[model samples]
Target chain A: MKYILSFVLNGQPVDVLAEPTDTLLDVLREKLRVMSPKRGCDEGDCGACTVLLNGEPVRSCLTLALSVAGQEVMTVEGLSKNGKLHPLQRAFHEHYAAQCGFCTPGMILAAKALLDKNPHPTREEIVEAISGNLCRCGTYQEVLEAVQAVARGEYAEVKE
Target chain B: MGECIYFAPTEIGEAVRLLAEYREKVTVVAGGTDLLPKINYYQLKPEVLLHIGRLGLDYIKEADGKLVIGAATPTSKLASNPLVAERASALAEAARQSGSAAIRTTATIGGNLANASPAADLATPLLILDAELLLTSTRGNRKVAINDFFVGPGKTVLEPDELLIEVSLPHQKGKSVFLKLGRRKAMTLSVVNVAVRLEMEGAQCKDARIALGAMAPVPLRCTRAESLIKGQVLDKSLIDRCAAEAVAESSPIDDQRATSWYRKKAGTVLVARALARAADMEG
Candidate 1:
């Protein structure tokens, strides 16, 4: 039941041996050793396992590993360039958006997916984009401020 | 637990052929929003996982005086498509309120209908739009009215070998609105949802359709309530009566989302509001 699943991972091509039942989240965290995407609910209800599939946010836990063949997958590890933090990451750091740091990865990726498509999202749009992600530490206010700061072009130079 | 075979078909013909070959053993997954939860929880163990996302069924177009939507079309596309918004505003609204942005990106209309949840956000709107589903198989294709599609909660009339290929909506002259009273604004199932469509000729209602969700074993069309307003001028009193009738037609059950009693009260109010909005009435 194991198959060679080939895909573009964070701008690089990868081929992993995975079972048909293996979820993209499992392959990334276990098989491929990319640990940004976490498995919280295992079900799609909780957005802890969210990652960008083809530049759009999706539930990695719900996505079959084999189904992502020949598609682009992006995790938080793929965010930075030249060993520098992406603007969103810098904003989150400066704004103290991470307390427990569990939902931070998924939250940042979700916001990145939103900003990539729409650079100037409104406060409401920012909320809608990350509504699926649940931060148990109750860091939503800080998360909002961080994302809003990025939208305001405060970290425009840091973006790559 | 046996090994599961995964098949991602790039062509519609191949997809249907796989369905025909595997029959009931194949679990068709598009978004995996619904199916994956079962699989992950070990509630469903299928011998085959047939992925039809790349079968080129994602489209929205007008043909033969009807709006044809590919079954595999994502909910996010439906929510944003100009044609769907212009022609099926209620459906667009329903799609927009379906799930969070992440879930909506993957969830398909076909998967939504085929899953047959009583609280399916798309069902009530499609019912009011008088949509028809085209189910295809190796045998052939057959169209089923949206009303006749649902068998019960978590069940549909789709045969084991059949695939829902398309959903078509005929031209309708009406102002329609969909309302959902969920636990929260986003990422929640409907406590009670309603969609109402009113084709008005000046002051009189030319035709009317009312559909309710989560208040019955299936997403239900309120024919009796719709008949009350048809060919009559919609007034506050008549709309109230129609709302009551719609709730009366539903046999709600108590669940985690809501109680049957609460659903009756909320369903009535939601239907009345949807009716008033569709008819361009006030209060």
Candidate 2:
């Protein structure tokens, strides 16, 4: 019942023991201890467990670990480089977007997926992109602003 | 709920062999957007999981004027596929409206059909598109009309030894419309969904198909409604009557998303809207 799952985590290659039934979220949080992605609804109904699978946002909770064998996966912890927080994180801090902060990781990753595809997304586009992520903190307006700030060229150098 | 073994086969022949070898001990999981939850929630427990993820089943192809969608083709692909968007706009729109971005990205069209949820967004459109499902086994392959694929909710006619390989449809030659009324704007189950496809000859409805979801134990084609509109020049009076016939085809039960009474009434309205939109597409 045990299988070895190999994937690129952040920018490093990782090989981890996994159960075929175990989800990527389970392995990432428990086995790998890369715990930025939160488990809100075990079902795919909520985006709390959203992570980047091969540069596309997917619900980690719904993704089987076996399915992700030899693929690239990214979580919010991987966003920062050289000890500098990603612009979306910095923007969230400045905009006060995190109330309870539980949803921040998923929110930032979801927004990053959008910004990666569309560097200069419109306000509506930003909203639609993060629509899957639910912020019970009622910080939706501020989250919108944080994503909008990143799109407004507030951190152009961050892309490099 | 218990320990399970998973098999990942890279070849279709190997996959078919595994299915035959394992039989009922195995369950096929492609997207796992639906199956994983059931496993986690203890709704389903199979000793072996036959994962088709690595089988290279994720594909969209055009063969002999027919659009062939692989069993593992993600919902996101159908939503934005240029060929699907142009030829089968209703299905594309249904894909676009289903679940959310993450769900669309990971969920496959085959999983949507195989799960056989009555509220499945893609099923109604696929039903109206006259889609055919191809199932394969060690014995050979067989084609089943999408219309006859579903037996009941959360059930399909797939045998334990058979795996759905492809879904095919001829280029839709009609103006089509899809309407889904969900509890929320996104990531919610449809209360009532309707798909209408009209083949028009200068405003006269040459042929028609009306499919409704969340209206019965299975997604249904409104043959009576199609009969009313077929060969008739659609107008306000005929459209109204056609909508009524579509409603008559529904047999829903009360559930968390909606009540039978509300669905009975809303089903008619959604069908009417879909037909009206299809007519406008002709205009």
lDDT of 1 at B15: 83
Q: In model 2, which residue pairs have backbone atoms overlapping below 3 Å?
A: none
| Superposed Cα deviation of residue B243, candidate 1 (Å) | 0.2
Q: Model 1, range A1-160, lDDT digits (tens) per residue?
A: 7889999999999999988778899899999999999999988887988999999999999898888999999999998988899999999999999998988999999999999999999999998898889888988889899999998999885534
Report the lDDT tens digits of candidate 1 across residue range B13-90. 898899989898999998888888888888998799899888889999999999999999999999999999999999
**Top candidate, metric TM-score:** 1
Q: Please report the TM-score between candidate 2 and the true structure.
A: 0.97
Which runs in model 1 stand beyond 4 Å of their true positions? none
lDDT of 2 by residue, B1-283 (tens): 5788988899999999999998989989999898989877778887998999888888888999999999899999999899888889999999988988888888998899999999899999999999999999999999999999999998899998999989999887788899999887777789999999988887699889999999999999999999998998888778889999998888989988889999988988888888878887323
State each candidate's clash count: 0, 0
Global lDDT of each candidate: 0.92, 0.89
User: Candidate 1 chain A — worst ten consecutive residues by lDDT sum?
Assistant: A151-160
True contacts kept of each: 0.71, 0.73
